[model samples]
Target: MRPETGMSATGFPALVLFDLDGTLLDSAPDFVATIDVLRAQRGEAPIAADQLRPHVSRGARAMLAAAFPRLDQAAREALVPPFLAIYREQLARHGAPFEGVEALLAAIEGSGSRWGIVTNKPEALARALLPLLGWQARCAVLVGGDTLALRKPDPLPLLHAAQALGVAPGDCAYVGDDERDIIAARAAGMPSVVALWGYRPEHDDPATWQGDALVASAHALIDPAAWPRPR
Candidate 1:
């Protein structure tokens, strides 16, 4: 069955939250480029972007694994810092908001609702990336993976974001691309939407994530009617 569509029992959501990497930002290009740079340093040919795209949501380590399949777990873990360092240098050089994101943000603002980000990305990186997109001042709240002792799939980050926005969890809806995003929203007592356009491995399935709704693209989010309603 389709999830309920509007405000929850608490009220219409005062704030809408998004996950950074795969959901709001199309950051895979920059991520893949960074991995290619690493490969070049080792005299290895660059891997295809599509090969590493799905692992972007899973983080740097995953992308590294995809790029260097022969590396042992310890060797892969060792590349995380270098990967992030290179990524930081080229964070938004190729990154851009997903199609229709600007209009969606404008619609949210015009409707008198606040919007923010809750991402598993490190706080420093998240902070650094926002300004590159000129969203540093516009976002109402931002909760990074390091913002608290807990992260997505644990619910604390989502709950913390709602509290910081001065809105009840029931009055917020989170949009993300990962299963952990839905699990966290559910545990926080908030509704969630899965962004189908975001990163997903061939074996991954959004349908089984149990989000309140599934949106095909950012453009769909511009319409208030497309949001998940209260059950």
Candidate 2:
């Protein structure tokens, strides 16, 4: 394989896996706009993007809950459709790859290494977003929350992504912003990195997630040394 570029391969891992919503794509802007549109339609005060940003990485349900904290389960479910519609319409408008993501992906791919995504987003919506972000052709594979019978923190989705990419779970590394992401990677026997750049509620801490590594920025991920080589 080609030597890993963009950074010194002091301890490069075999395969690199990614989280979509927060780690790869900065999706909060689009999500916030959708919330504003929905709230305005309902004659309610619009929520700010920063208020909803952290939950965007958590998935649509979380964003909906954040936007309508007083709503019951039934009302929350009802709001999903409209929120999704507006989100789709503005999907590419403000959302984009996080800083250095394109370069990181390119460097990884150019190094003769393979990378893919494992996200809690639904397959249809995630698939739609990828193309808009120009990642549809770059990522080797994408495992959405609905891709299998279960999602993150269950290990199954990560395992499925590794299997589909012809790599062992132990050979892959997962990078994300939440505890569930680290938990799933650990359960699947895959190494993980906690992405500090992604959205996290004020009460959360990436250090507490207990990932193999903690990345301070998106650019750091391109450094092969960030991933300890397998023994």
Candidate 3:
């Protein structure tokens, strides 16, 4: 902690932006429930949650790809509409924030820093999650994948959030679980922290993502000094 600032040495970043699925909320159980229903309709047994969890961060398409490797492209594409319909019903039914997330969020706010979400989840779906996650009024901003012309890996969402908050892009710190998350943050001129506690396949290497900081859990993120300084 820095005595004069009464904060971490660098203080918390002015804005702390997080990705949805793998970073802040552990919504995989809901996704798993959605996908398993589709699997059941085809007389297929529900796929293992372990098999589907890591890929959830990549979104529905990736989850489908992992679940139905036996299905060709078109068949899986056809499952999307039904998949989403089922997902809407299952939202937050069995999902909640990852352990330690609430405390971490409180810590960020306690430091007088604003935090928000910038996620590739669709706007309606993401908005639906706010109350379920108890973040309906706490977040300063929420930018979903469809909120902008483009989403993660495009930098637009992150930049848009910063602009909406009247913060310079460099004053924000982005946290996420995917390579695309780090890419978007970089393009938006914000330093990024890799959520190692989030999802990824065994073969995917986040070390190659080149983020400014990497943390093991939401608990680790509670420490103000863990955040990177503005660029």
lDDT (C-alpha, whole model) for all candidates: 0.87, 0.81, 0.88
lDDT for each residue of candidate 2 in 1-231, tens digit (9 for 90 to 100): 233322224344556788888888888888888899988988998797788987877777898999999999799999888888888888779878889888888878877777888898878888888777777787788888888999998999998887776776776788888889999999998888888889888899777887888888878867777774442
Per-residue CA lDDT of model 1 for 1-231, tens digit only, reads 222234533333567999999999999989978998999998999889899999999887789889999999999899889998999998999989999898888888777788899999999999998888999889999999989999998999998887875777877899999999999999998889999999989999899999999999999887777887633
In candidate 2, stretches whose alpha carbon ends up further than 4 angstroms from where it belongs are: 1-11
Model 3 ranges off by over 4 Å = 1-10
- Looking at model 3, residue 213 earns an lDDT score of 96
lDDT of 3 at 132: 80
Q: Where's the lowest-lDDT run of ten residues in candidate 1?
A: 1-10
Model 2, position 201: C-alpha lDDT score: 87
- What's the residue-level lDDT of 107 in candidate 2? 77
Across 1-231, the per-residue lDDT of candidate 3 in tens digits comes to: 211212333378878899999889888999989988998989999988999998999988989999999999999999888888899999899888988999988888887888899999988999998998789999999999888889889999998898888788888899999999999999999999999989999998988999999999889878777887778
Off by over 4 Å in 1: 1-12
Q: lDDT score of model 1?
A: 0.87
**Top lDDT prediction, candidate number:** 3
Give model 1's TM-score versus the native structure: 0.94
* TM-score-superior candidate, 1 or 2: 1
TM-score of each: 0.94, 0.92, 0.94
For model 2, the run of ten residues with the poorest summed lDDT: 1-10
Number of clashes found in candidate 3: 0
